[model samples]
Target chain A: MKKLINSPDSVIADALRGMAAAHPALSVDHDTRVISRAGGAAQGKVGLVSGGGSGHEPLHGGYVGPGMLDAAVPGEIYTSPVPDQILAATKAADGGAGVLHIVKNYTGDVLNFRMAAELAEDEDIRVSAVVMNDDTAVEDSTFTAGRRGTGATVVAEKIAGAAAAQGADLDAVTRLVTEVNDRSRSFGIALHAGTVPAAGTPGFELGPDEVELGVGIHGEPGRERGSMAPVRDLVAYALEAINADRPVGGDVLVLLNGQGGTPLIELYGAYAEAVDWLEGHGATVTRNLVGNYITSLDQAGFSITVTALDDELVRLWDAPVETPALRWGR
Target chain B: MKKLINSPDSVIADALRGMAAAHPALSVDHDTRVISRAGGAAQGKVGLVSGGGSGHEPLHGGYVGPGMLDAAVPGEIYTSPVPDQILAATKAADGGAGVLHIVKNYTGDVLNFRMAAELAEDEDIRVSAVVMNDDTAVEDSTFTAGRRGTGATVVAEKIAGAAAAQGADLDAVTRLVTEVNDRSRSFGIALHAGTVPAAGTPGFELGPDEVELGVGIHGEPGRERGSMAPVRDLVAYALEAINADRPVGGDVLVLLNGQGGTPLIELYGAYAEAVDWLEGHGATVTRNLVGNYITSLDQAGFSITVTALDDELVRLWDAPVETPALRWGR
Candidate 1:
C-alpha cells in the first residue's frame, strides 16, 4: 500500500495539469480530462482518437502527434475515461476529414468509446471505431467481453496514426487500425503485481518466487501461476502461446512490451527468445520493437506482440509520425 | 534472484537465438552479438554504432535504423559490453566512410566503447564518439567518470542517425550527437529497485513506501531516497532538479521516460505533471515524449528528459529513421 503519490483522488487532476505544461503541442481539458495537442485539429486530415485507463499511458496521449492520434482522453489510473471526455477529444480532433476511434477491447473502454461514438454520430460528425482485441490471453473469460486488448493496442495506434497522417479518411483509418488488430497478437507474463492507486496495494499477489503467465494488463488473473522460471522458459511458453494462436509465419512487425517494470535487457532477452522461436517456426520478422510500448502500471513483467505484416502495412508503418509518443519524418 | 531463465550463463545466448528467429529483418551474430537489419548498412556511408548493457533494449540496438545507428552491441543485463565485442561490431558496421560511436556516459559503457574506438583507430578505421552525459540526476554522477547519460542518449542517437543517413561524415555525425547531448538533460526517480540477473536481487533498495530520486539506468544509487510522495511532488522534485541544472527556460523537447516497469498511464501522469511544472515555472515546452525510451530493467519508476530545441536540432530530430525500434521512413 506504500506509494509516493499525494492524495490518490488528486493523482489524475494533478497529472493532467502537468501534461498540459510539458508539451505546448498538447492541451488538456481539465474539466473533461481530454488531452489534445495544442494544434486543436489537423485541418483536413482524418482525426484519430484513443483513450482508456490512465495507467496505460503514452498510449492515447503520447501517440497524439503528427502521424499519430490528434487527441487522447485519459481516465484515472487503470480506469476508463468518461464518455463525455471521449466526446470532447473526438470533437477537438475532428477537422473537415472526419474521425476514427481506436478502442482497446475492454469492457469499460468499449462501452465508453462506443457510447461516445454513437453520440458523435447523432451530432452528424463522421466517426468510425476499431475495437482492438489482440490479446490471446483470454479466449473465454467471464470478466472480459472476449479477448482483452493488451499490447497490440500500440500497433493499432502506430499504424492508424501513420494512415491518418497520410490523409486516410476515417474509414481508411478504421480499416487500417482494424487490420493491425487483426494481424497482431499478444500474451504476457507477470512476475510481480501492480498497485492500482485507489486500491493502494498489489492488484494480485504472488510469493517471493512466483510468476503468472497469460496475464492481462489490468492484473486480471492469468491462465496459470507458478514458481518463477528462467527468462528462456518464460519466453518459450509465451511465444508458443502467441505463435499457436496467431501463427506469425509471415512478414511481421513485433513489439516486446513491458507490463511496466520489466527491464529493457530482459525484454531483449524475451525478444531474442521469441525471434528464435519465430524463425524456427518459419516466420519473417520484418520490423521489430523492443521496449515498453503498452504497459500496466509498474507491473514487473513483459509481453510480446506480433503483427503479421503485409506490404501495405509495412509501407504505412514507415510513414512519418510526430506525436508526443512517436515522431518521425523530416 | 527468482528469475525464469534456465541459467544465468546461457540467458544471453538463448535470448539471441530467439531474437534472430523472431526478427528476420534484424540478424544477430551469435558469435559477436552484433544485431542489424538485413540488407541495411549503406555502403560507403559512415556507420553509426552504439551499445551498452543488454537491459536497455531498443536503445543502441532498437535505434539501429536508416538515420540512426547502424549497429547496436549488447552486453549482459545492466553490464557493459566488453571491448572485443564493441570492436567486432564496429568492424562489421565499418564502411569506407568510417564509424561513429554513440556512447553513453557510464564508466563501463564509456570504457568499453572507448577502447573499441581506440582499437578501431589503430586499425585505421576513423572513429569518433559522443559521450552522452545528459542525466542531471546526481551532479557529477551521470557517469562513474563524470555526469551520467540518461534520456538524452536517445536524442543523440536520433540526431546522429539522421546525419549519418544523409551521408554526413563521421565528424559531422559526432558533432551533431554532441550538440544534442549538450542541449539535453534528464532526471529520474525510482519507486522501486531493479533485479540484476547476475546479482539475483534488487540493484538497490528503498522502503516499500519510499521513492528514490536521481536514479541511474543500472540501478546505480540515486541522489535521494525518501518516503514516496504524491505524483505532483515527485515530478516537481525531478523537474526542479533538471530546470536548475540544465535550465530549459525556452523552447524545449521534454521526454518522460519509464525506467522499464512503469506503465504508460503512469508515465503520462508524470508527463502531465512535468508539463505543468515546467509551464508553471515559466518554461516553454516545444515537443514532448513519454514512454520507456531509456530503461533500467524492471525498475518501477520513471525519468524526465528535456532538450533545449533549436531549428537545426529540431530538423535533425524530425528526419526519417528506420530501425527495429524506431521506423518512420521506408
Candidate 2:
C-alpha cells in the first residue's frame, strides 16, 4: 500500500508523535501508547477513557481533551490494544472519583478493556464500562460477536464525556454513555476496501459496478453486495435499515462520516440525502456532523449514524468540547 | 468513477444542499452557488470573498463564517467560477467598508475574479484582490501563468479573514493576504490522481511503485515522478523544495494537508516528519494544522505549507475561526 508511513510496525508510534507535536493541549505517552490531557485528569471529576484499533483515527485518541476522553489507548491498526495498554490508559485517566471506559463492541476490544478494568480494580480503582454496539449493519462480524460499533462511538464519547466533565459521578457518566449508545444506530457502505500497510493490499475487493452495503469498519462482510446506486438511494437504504431497527423520530443528532478515502464533497452530498431522508420521515435534525470521524484506514465509504436526542443530550452536545477531532464552544 | 454523488452533472448542487443542511451558520444560495454567512456580513467590517472550482472543498465555501470569508462562490468541479457568480458573491459580501477577494493563482480563477471585481466596481462596491501563487514546485504549469496556489490558500484565508473581521479596511486585508502569500511556500506529492466525476477517470496515472512529486491540486504534472519511498524521504523532498524557493526560519505556521483520499492516521504520520524537518532546518513551528483542509477530490497525497510568522501574523493566526473544515477558539 502507498501509505505515508515509515513502516507498518511504526505507524501508531509515528502518528502519536505527530499528535503530540500538533496538539500541546494533549500529551502522548509513547511507551504506553496512551494519549491523555496535558493537564492531567481533574481531581474530582470522573475520568473518561476510550480506545480501540489505530486505523479509525479521530476516534479514541483524537477525542482526548477537556469535555471528552481523558485518555485514549490505541492498539495496532485494526487490532485491539493489549490489556497492559488499556490498563495504562485507565490509570492515567483515574482522578480519584472513578474512571469510565467507553468501548466499542468488538470481541477483542471488549475483552481487552474488561481485562484492563479488572486489572484496574485490583489496584482499588473503581471503573465503569460501557460497550457500544450501534452498528445495525450486522448482528455479528469477523471480529465482533454483536453489532460492530461504528459512528455512534463518536456521539457517545462526546455526549458522555461532556457529562463526565461537568462533574457527573462514575455511575451517572456510565448511565449517560449507555443511554447514548442505546439511542444510536449506524450503517455503512463501502466503495472500496482499505489496504493494511503490512498487508500491502486491500482486505477485500469490489467489482467496478458493485458496492458493499452495511460494511463494517475493518472490511468485514456486510449484509450484502449491491449494484451501484445514487447517493439518495444509498442513504435511503441506510436509513431504512436504521428505522427498521430503531424507528428514528423526534429531535435527533446525525453523523455522516466518510470512510478514509471518501472526499468531503461526497460526504456533504451524502449528508444532504441523509437530512432529506430524516426530515421527510418526520425527524427534526437538531445537531449534525458531516466529515470523517471514525475512519477505516483508507477505505472509500460512508456511514450514517443517528442518535435520538433529548433536551439534556442536546445541551451536552452543545457544551464546550476541546479535542483534536471534535472541538467547539471552548 | 466510484464517488458518493447523485450524478456527475448534479454533484455541486447536491453537495451544496448537504452543506446547507450540515452547517446552520452558513447560508447557501442554490441559484448563484454562493455560500455566505447566515447572519449576513457585519456592517462596516471589510467583507472577505473567495471562490474557485468546487472539488477543493472547505476551501472557499467551508471558510465562510464569522471570522473567515463573508461569501464564497463555487463553480463546477475543477472549473473556475463564472464572473457572474463571483460578482454575486462580491455584492453579497459588500459591507460599507468594501470587500477583498482572495484568489488562487490558476489562470481561469485569476481572470474570472478580476472580471468580477470590475463588475463589482460598476455596482459601486470597492473590491481589492490578492492572488496567491505559493506552490514552489514549478514557476509555470498547465493552468497557471506563474506558480500555482495550493495549501497556502487556507492560511491566507484564516489570517487575512481575521484582519477583515477585526475591521481592517479592504486595502489592509488585501495587503495582509498578500503578505501571507509572499511568506508562505508549499509543495505537494501524490500517490494517485483524483478522478473528476465528469471525467469518469483519474486526471492522471502513476505506476504502482511511483509517485508524482509537486503535483498540482488539479492533477496537473508536478516537478517530477519518482519511485515511492518512505514518508520521511518524501517529506524531506517537499521541504527541500520550499526551502530552496524561500529559506524557512524563525516562527512558522505549517499546514500538512491531505490530498482528499489520504487517511488522518497517515496525515499525522507524515506531519511528524514535517515537524522534525522544520525544526532540524532551524525553523520553529509556532502553529500547525494537520488535516484535509484543501483537497483534490479522491487523490492519495499530501502537501506541506510553511508560512513564516511575525508577532502580528501569529496573533491573527491564533484568532478565532469557525468554519466547517478549519475551526478553533470562538
Which candidate leads the pack in lDDT? 2
Each candidate's fnat = 0.66, 0.83
Per-residue C-alpha lDDT of model 1 across residues A291-328, encoded as one tens digit per residue: 65677777778888889988888888877776655655
Please give, for residues B238-306, the per-residue lDDT of candidate 2 as tens digits.
Answer: 999999989999999999999999999999999999999999999999899999999999999999999
Candidate 2: share of reference interface contacts reproduced: 0.83
Clash pairs, model 2 backbone: none
TM-score per model (chain B): 0.94, 0.99
Index of the highest-TM-score prediction:
2
Clash counts per candidate, in order, are 51, 0
lDDT of 2 at A123: 97
- The 0-to-1 C-alpha lDDT of every candidate, in the order given, reads 0.77, 0.92
Cα deviation at A311, candidate 1, in Å, is: 6.4
lDDT of 2 at A40: 86
Q: For each candidate, give its TM-score against the true structure.
A: 0.83, 0.99
